[model samples]
Target: MDARQKQLCIGEGFHNIDYRILKSIVDCIYEAVCVIDENGIVIVWNKGAEKLYNIAYKDIIGENIEDIFPDAIVNNVRKTGVSVENKYHSPRENSYILANSMPLYIEKVFKGAVSTDRDFAELIKLYFELENANSKLIFLENEVKKISGVFGNIIGKSPNIVKKIDMARQIAPTHASVMITGESGTGKEVFARGIHELSGRKGLFVPVNCSAIPSELFESEFFGYCAGAFTGANKKGKMGIFELADEGTIFLDEIGDMPLHMQAKLLRVLQEREIVRLGGEKNIKLDLRVLAATNKCLQEMVRESKFREDLYYRLNVVEINLPSLRERKEDIPIFIDYFIKEFSTRNSKKIIGTQRDVLNILNEYKWPGNIRELMNVIEHIIVTNKNGMIQKNSIPEYILSQAKKSESFKEYPLDLTKAIKKLETENIKKALKISKNNKSKAAKLLNIPRGTLYHKIDEYKIKCPK
Candidate 1:
């Protein structure tokens, strides 16, 4: 081989073998590979380069690379005898590459430069696609946050309250019937409204108080009577609660109070998804969701045949039970703050906050009336108070009397060690209660490590609920 071809070999010892091996190695590489001589003439161009640049090796071999690729990194390496590592380059419009060019030297003579380029066009396309997908995901998350904000009215961050709110969000998007069970004044209607808002149903939310509707007027009130169907009916006819809530949600408040006779008709409407107006032959279809709330134990009533078992099962597809105020006392302080601000704004008052002693007394008292009682108490304070801060005298006498009675029953310990141990055990128990006996969550609530919490539990002989 002549001197021009000999330069392609790495060294004299393995000239033929090394030249064939190097050629084979370059051929195997997927990245675009190009080599130029000291004069910037193209000597090696692999198939990758041909596909990337749309230039054939046979047509470009022995030609000046600068004439075809003026911005090529190989030309720069050949001129400067310097290496370029992982540099980004754009050879033409819509073409991008990451290239690494190294100066080739044999016997202290700069032979040429070798470059390998990775096409970045596909990578850029994928990056844009990922960015678009991320934007859509962020939008969906924001929408969910907006929907969840409706629950902000329910208040309280206790584990029980949080679990109920989470369960509400999970079932809101589906068409399943939800049964909200809690004590009276526990804000069951608030939960039902929040669910309807998140359900994506466009129709109005029609609330029906079963106890308030007379049994004689149940059919006409629920399924509107047609013109002349009744002696005093409107000539144009009227829409009943079910028809008014078409394509929306029907909140059956006090569902347990519905008479047994009306329960069968309601069940038929739910199963048939249609209702016939009184004296009307046509059956009007309904596309609606049902949400029910009750303060009574329907399960026990079902056993007694007071509530229809079949209707009970149909409405109780998913049950969300709200905790009473006494069950989540940790949230009372915030509840106080929320109600104070709400009443203050409505009543045009600037009550800054409640006195610390007043808060202590309020916290100690068990709120049997739940959030409704708390709201009433705050409203009473806001309305009667003449000063900026809520004082003990401004609170109702009933609550004050109850708090004094509760304080009289408490005992105090003088020993420092014993007091400390008692306080620790009480706090640990409170943490366990708040976390629903989840050891990890309880430890977090107590601001202690899991191991330390376990040790304390064992040392105090505390019984954790299952």
Candidate 2:
């Protein structure tokens, strides 16, 4: 049956196979393929090759391939038996191409050459888009590097601060969980961020203000939860802080205040190098560098049974204690100038230097609030004294009040209750003097409720000295 069918087809001489089918296949391929002989004679050129080179295969065959395109530079490929790739055109207009050329080899001998090319017009457009995105990404990276206080962020001339910065830089390359310790106003978080910035991690920083979050939510907040994990959980699920900080740094601020139970969970995460989402079964591998900062001493908390002793040691691989502003007053002028300029530009104000006397007062007065307070003071000065150079007079009443705060109240024949009342009055008067009687801001600085401060003022009959 097969022989008869084949004989009938041969007799009719109608195979019906079309060459267009072959050419159609070549035209559809995105990459242009070209084949040439030893003398650089174009033997096989696909439609894609023709369209790409802007010359038809019919026009190129039997012609010297090198002389035909000129830009093809086929002579070099023939002479050297080497292929060229991604070579740019010397005089290009709207387009470019990525060429992959290979000298055709058969039985260990070079026969001719074959090439494939991809149009760069679309690729160049993509490259420009990529370049724009990369430029913006780099700018953002630079900005983040600055804010994170890496090499570029730690700005200060004071030897003490510089020494600390140098130490931080020395330790930045290691994969260590650094514990930064300092008073509430010291720049502990800055050091933590600086460590992360220096580590070259591209992940987002996840800072957990341990004191700010409610204890019940710690596990869910740090390790996240699967969908339907909790009664009111998000349907699609959530990515926890630790997951977000993967391959990056997690800054646990106020670590001393972290709850004992949460501290235990944190210890497990540190030890296991992984975390299981709350109310979920799977364990997520965590690749994170933990940087913790606290005003309260962990050793003290551990002794008091408030902090887990095990966690303390785990987090304290390296410790960087930020110096209080009082200890680093020499850095104050540097800080002051930096802050004033920043706020001036942000607030768009013309305010500049405080009087020399005021600067001296700033230097002398103990900045209990540290860097944060200094920055706020600069902002306040700019807001309040907007038009002119700041003066000693423009300095807030608080700076001046410290000197007068110790003065005793003038009274005679002091009764036990009256004497106590007089002392209270004197203290309140001093606070008013220092705060310039800005009760609200004064209350903030004093770390007390505004209502409580007002009650005390009423009870003591405190007034600003005229």
RMSD in order of candidates: 20.1, 23.6
Pull out the clashing pairs in model 1.
none
Deviating ranges (above 4 Å) for candidate 2: 1-148, 403-466
- lDDT tens digits by residue: candidate 1, 319-389: 99989988998999999987776666566566656789999988988888889998999999999889778
* Candidate 2 lDDT tens digits, 1-466: 2445433432332134353464567677878777666667665568787777677766665566667666664456767877787765531355467777777765666667777777878676776567556655665665776775665756567777788888888888788888888888787777777778788877767778989989898888888889999799999899899999998889999998888888888998899999888778888897888999899878888898888888999999988888888887788888888777666555546563568877877787788888888888878887777456988766788877863453223352358887777666766677667888888877876677889888988776666565
> Candidate 2 overall Cα lDDT vs. reference?
0.75
Question: Model 2 reaches what TM-score against the true structure?
Answer: 0.56
- Model 2: per-residue Cα lDDT at residue 37: 62
lDDT of each: 0.85, 0.75
For model 1, give the 10-residue run with minimal summed lDDT: 7-16
How far residue 362's Cα lies from its native spot in candidate 2, in Å, is 0.8
Off by over 4 Å in 1: 1-149, 411-466
lDDT of 2 at 262: 85
TM-score of each: 0.56, 0.56
Number of the top-ranking candidate, with lDDT as the measure: 1
